[model samples]
Target: MRGAAMSLSAAASGFVVFLLSVSVVQGQDDWGVTYTSTEICALKGSTVDISCTYRYPSRINDHITQVKEKFWFTRVSNNDYVDIRSDPEYSGRVQYIFGNNDCTLRITDLRESDSAEYKLRFITNQHNGKYTGSPGVTLSVTGMVTDLQVQVSRLLVYKSYNRAELKCHSSCRLPDHLHYVWYKNRQKMWRGTSSYSVSVYPADSYSCAVEGYEKFPSPPVYAPRVPSVSVSPSGEIVEGSSVTLTCSSDANPAANYTWYKENEVSPKASGQIFTITDFRPEHSGNYYCEAQNRRGRHNSTLHLIVVAGKFLHSATHILYQKS
Candidate 1:
């Protein structure tokens, strides 16, 4: 109800704010306030304007009702309304603009705590000419840094590609009609709905941001890239010698690695590094590392050969490398 005085009350439970509207009685219009809007949703570190017009009778008990003071307050402390401008938390951030029968409250550098019901209250020269606009305006501020996130969901992974769902998410409720911008490798891809579906590749990175705040995009999310396998000694796996195999991959959520030898039903080892203290011919085979995450997995193979037995006992060296 634009400019209509309505009795209002609010109750906050958890993260949700609820506003209740009630009918105003007749004769309350003689001195009442009308707001341009009753609800506002803004992003953190942004600015907002809550404007309203007020009314008062010309005379009370035959005395002129001269306006003495007008201000905005969200609550009453010690049975007195505290002016928003005087609040230390809002100091240097609140500006009041008064025009012909209208008053606008301008707030800058908004914070999540600024989410509250703001009301317009005024005092007149007359003894009983004080009025407060009930159920004023509700301001809900979302975040610019912490809350915005890109949530990744793995739909399906087949062969060399993975089907994924990406959602632009926030801690507080934002307007449902907000246009979202998607980024692939930090480059703008398209502007569309908040949720997007795309085929994922191992080397691609994805992020999301609101349309107007592209610079503050959510952290990039990507699948594990093809892993690279390496050996510590890098030369040869000699009999009764120790050797270590390491697998590494780049992924948003770090990938977990498993070591397996060809023809083995179960995994040989679990971790980024797999070590064999006593090298033997039985360990000579095609050993592959599987780097896996929620997104998908990739394998890198390393062929190992042990230089043992009397035939090559004095050979001292055997070449082993990753395949």
Candidate 2:
């Protein structure tokens, strides 16, 4: 009976060893690395995180030991690789999140130069136990721009006054923590929110910009407003006299001025001021000044009459004949 009991115990121990060997073989066959995302897109001046998980056999050739080192790299040359954390370009911007079987790389203040392929490598204490994940994540960094939209209230406040609403937007949904800024005629008018409301006025010009990037504001937009015309002489225009017409308007980026005559398809002059030296009778016509910008355009008209020298003399002779 004692011999039989010892034999049974030895057979059970052998069975357990056989099962352990099979388990080790299965784990080794499944050793590999996988990334959460093969490709990732990030905005310039923003932050991004790349994640990965790795697995390895617990025992290789009956050798079991702790992992010696792990790191991330972009290139491998001549059997040598440089860790991204040690690279000068990523000195302050890169951070590593490491775990027993998982790792993550975080990059902040991203720039176009940060775009690259990133791979993770690990080495174990066992001799010649090093593995690198091939075809790693690809990172793409792009610039962010502000977009501005204008909306008008359908209902008027006082039966004739409508309010204009300006909203700031971006291509990618930005964090709600970020604040917005509003500008009119290059002067800051509002801040703290993405939307701003104001009394509608044709003469007002407006634009939107982000808080950190005030210098690069969105293109200005303005509702068309009638241009104001002023003559240099400030009186009746006479023939053979030099005359100058100045056009002014309240427009974002300032309005471009163009002078046109009635029945003419083409503009007679282009600029804020139009000058006609030695004015002639043919110059007498209905003139209009057009103020335009990227937002819209407006026109204001003025009738310019030039009296010939001969007409004044004829009028004086008629008065003498009547006397």
Candidate 3:
């Protein structure tokens, strides 16, 4: 019945009808996945490994085990992903770093133009049938610049105070891991996490250094790197409550925030903040924000409490900071 569903009877002669039916049936046939690349893109001009593993459906793999073939499909822009072998432009730049249930790709010396979507694809035979694969990893490339930026927030500088703490943020980078350093007036300071703060610089110049695969001039004094962060409010305040999470971070490039909750990573989750425009006891959770800089991430142990569950917008900031 699986294959027979595509056959059009004499009762249906329209090509559009046949095509529509094929699409509907094929929609149910999907590839399986397990592991995925923790990070999709690396620093500008660096090596990136897009890894993915999969287990075919029991009906598709029966008891089969050995893999017999492998290949890849590169997404050009949108709507089409073709073999890299056929495109002269990507010929030498693309290489199969490794292939298997865990297929990976090595894209070297990435340039801005190299910035786009990529994947690892393949196929293998199993006892049940031909275990063709739709399994793969997504890859994105980013630019690497040593130049840094400086910023300060909620600073309480006292008069005659010998020092003030200021933060640095590096934005526009996509690397998953790298080393971050603090620099002041051309000298290296202590290396902390991505968020580096030096005792007040007396109205002087400061910068940072992020070393990875990006190489150019003797890495100039870059803008300071900021850590990925989000602000949340306390949840105890309401039914029909309002909230917002301010996400800010430092990296050689800007840090991107992807919100998550419970068991859902992306699609199943909703809202930047859990806005209980209408209060309900069901709106409670151990809520927290996952902040990530290009190099690492930090999670706050936070929870949203809906006491008596009343609704109001004034408590948004309090609820947001709760977690």
lDDT of 2: 0.64
Please provide, for model 1 over 1-323, each residue's C-alpha lDDT reduced to its tens digit, 9 standing for 90 to 100.
33432222221211222222342321276877877767776667666667777888998788877899999999899998999988998988888888755788877777889999999999988887788888788898866634577777546767677788888886544545568899999999989988999887776788888777777788887766777787766655456777888889887668888888888899989999999887777767787888777666767787766554411211112122111
For model 1, the stretches where C-alpha displacement exceeds 4 angstroms are 1-42, 45-143, 146-148, 171-173, 309-323
Query: lDDT score, residue 103, model 1?
Result: 83
Superior candidate under TM-score, 1 versus 2: 1
What is the model-wide C-alpha lDDT for candidate 1? 0.72
**lDDT for 34 (candidate 3):** 36
Better of 2 and 3 by lDDT: 2
Per-residue accuracy of model 3 over 1-323 as CA lDDT, tens digit each: 12112222221111111111111111124444433432244344454444444444444435545556555665645755566656766666666644334554545555556555454444556543343233333344445454455554323433422233444444433222345566665566656555654444222345555544224212232222322223334433545545544434333223344454445455323333433344456655544444432223334323445445442222212122101
Residue pairs in candidate 1 whose N, alpha carbon or C atoms collide under 3 angstroms = none
- Candidate with more favorable, higher lDDT: 1 or 2: 1
lDDT of each: 0.72, 0.64, 0.41
Alpha-carbon runs more than 4 Å astray in model 2: 1-48, 54-68, 108-112, 123-167, 172-175, 184-187, 195-206, 220-323
lDDT of 2 by residue, 1-323 (tens): 00000001112111100000011111235465667666666557776767777777788788885678999999766878989888888888888888768777877777779889988888888787787777777787656454444333232333333455566665444445567788877689888777777764555667777677676687776754667776767655556778787788776546788888879999999998998888777777777778865445677766677554511111101000000
TM-score of every model versus the real structure: 0.55, 0.43, 0.40
